[model samples]
Target: MSLRTQLTEILPPLLPSNPSEAIKGTELIRLARLQLNGAYSDASLRYHFSIMSCDPASPIAKVEKGQGYYRRSAPVPALTGAQELLSLSQGRLDDLSSDHEAVDSALERLRKFRAVVTRYYEVNGRFPYVFRQAFAQGASLGNLWKFPEVVLVDWETGDAPDEVFALDPTMLSLKQRLGLPPFRLHAARLRIHPSLASFREDFFQALSASMWAQGGELIYAAPVEDEALADGLRRLNAIFGVGVISFGLTAQALDDLPRAANILNAHPRETEALMDRLQINRIAAPHTRQHIDWQSLDGLRRESEEVQHLIGWLNDCVGKGRAEAFRDEA
Candidate 1:
């Protein structure tokens, strides 16, 4: 059967006598045409019919313009809102000879798009508004069009979760494939100062003790310089096939510790509290040290409470063996 005839069989009937209904019916047909041909330049039966009978100022004209916008806004050459719609039509195209291959190709294209989007998120800590909006609209249409499988797969892979930790080989591979930076690189990006190295080592010792109390084994516990620690973590990550959590004591240490997956600051409780207050007040990190009111008892109390809360949260993350405990509440 012709693609148009097949589409008409499944789509709801629209009365030819009613202009509005006809416009809607023709749009559905146009979408099908775009899907099959990969472009809208070719004239189809519906296109010719519209040219002959459809009103010049009909709503269909607006939809046609919108479709053009959708195509032009594609992030990658192979993906656009129209192509996404095509991918969602996989199950409905079962009768088409090339359905399986077409669906697989569409899926692979979507995956590549996903990889780019994931990388953007990792670098910026948020999705670009245009792309996010496109994905949101696509997801809504996928459901409205009864393509549940498309929605399901996209949700499982495209959505980013909070506080991902690297602990195992599988997780490491998944993170790398998704464009997430390793712990060491992520920490280095934070650009924390070197004055806090002693604090980091102390924090690690405390954390190690807490884990040991909970029956978690500590394979390495020596106090090494920041570079040595980073090297150790890299070795452990490669040889032991696990994520390495290491500390850098100086600004230069971060450069040296390329293999560490997680780098934490080792500030005193009071210092941490002050930093928390600055962060809560939207103060820039560079200005935090100068802005803090050290002698304000009320401010001190508030900062202390914030520090305690952070420590408690970290404790929970350690207990759960998942970094998601650190995600800010929405």
Candidate 2:
């Protein structure tokens, strides 16, 4: 048997399923050798592990945040997990499998991912505005194409949470005179998986939703491990200017995270602990326009009550001469 074929059979039972307890390359190599039929150098064994880890069909997976390998989870039927959430949100549970446990698991992973994405931006100095109503039950499915789940506002300066940082009147006026908006907004579309079949749909959905924003981003919970999938995403990005990023999170890793509420409300120390688990990779940089498409935004504002609330929040911040994080209650 080929080395890769041999290793495939050898790795799964030997590998840990949890990412936190990932075994180092050397340790794995030593253990893998025990089952080997022929001589193989450490370099050769390590190379096979790295390469095989990228294949979804392969049993081996590399930890994104640390040094080690883990057993990849068996493929879930709805690999992307988006459709499961969509079906549940639309109250079409009957359309899904009779395995309601799997459905609930998918939904929890989706929710946790959203919370992680939100907290990731918050700690990184970008203020996030969530559009819950767009995804709420009874909302039209078309909203997926028309609205981003989150709008990231970069105010250029701020530190304290919910604490206001004064924007200088002089600088604000100067920016206005220069025809530059005081801040930039980038609309983001989040997905739990990256697949060749569905990525184009994912990319264009982000593009369609971000027509009114400065730029657009497509964020994935898992790594863009497949070369073909990565290349396809890059080609689309080159033409469309929408950014692509992978959090290096597998479905299993997301499942290991704290509940969505706990992730969102994590204290600094706890947040850091959570952040350490991520392996962030930027597949393509977003091309941010100098100005937002205000005309398109105005048109949207007329239709979406959520958009109106978003604008109202921004206006409140500007009026107060300080930027504060968006609170659902606020």
lDDT of 2 by residue, 1-330 (tens): 999999999999999976678888999999999999999999999989878876768888776554787776664344323443762232222234567787788789888999999999988878899887777757677888889988999874443454446665776678879988888899999888776546777898899999889999999998875554677789999999999999988977988899999999999999999999999999999999888889999988998888998998888877887878887774
Compute the lDDT for candidate 2: 0.81
Which candidate has the highest TM-score of all?
2
Clashing pairs in 1: 183-261, 184-260, 184-261, 194-250, 197-249
lDDT, each prediction:
0.28, 0.81
- Top candidate on lDDT is 2
Error of 1 at 204 (Å): 47
lDDT of candidate 1 at residue 5, scale 0 to 100:
45
What is the lDDT for 300 in model 2?
84
Question: Which segments of candidate 2 are over 4 A away from where they belong?
Answer: 1-84, 87-95, 158-164
Kindly give the stretch of ten consecutive residues in candidate 1 with the minimal lDDT sum. Answer: 147-156
Error of 2 at 235 (Å): 1.1
Local accuracy of candidate 1 as per-residue lDDT tens digits, 81-103: 33343332222222323466655
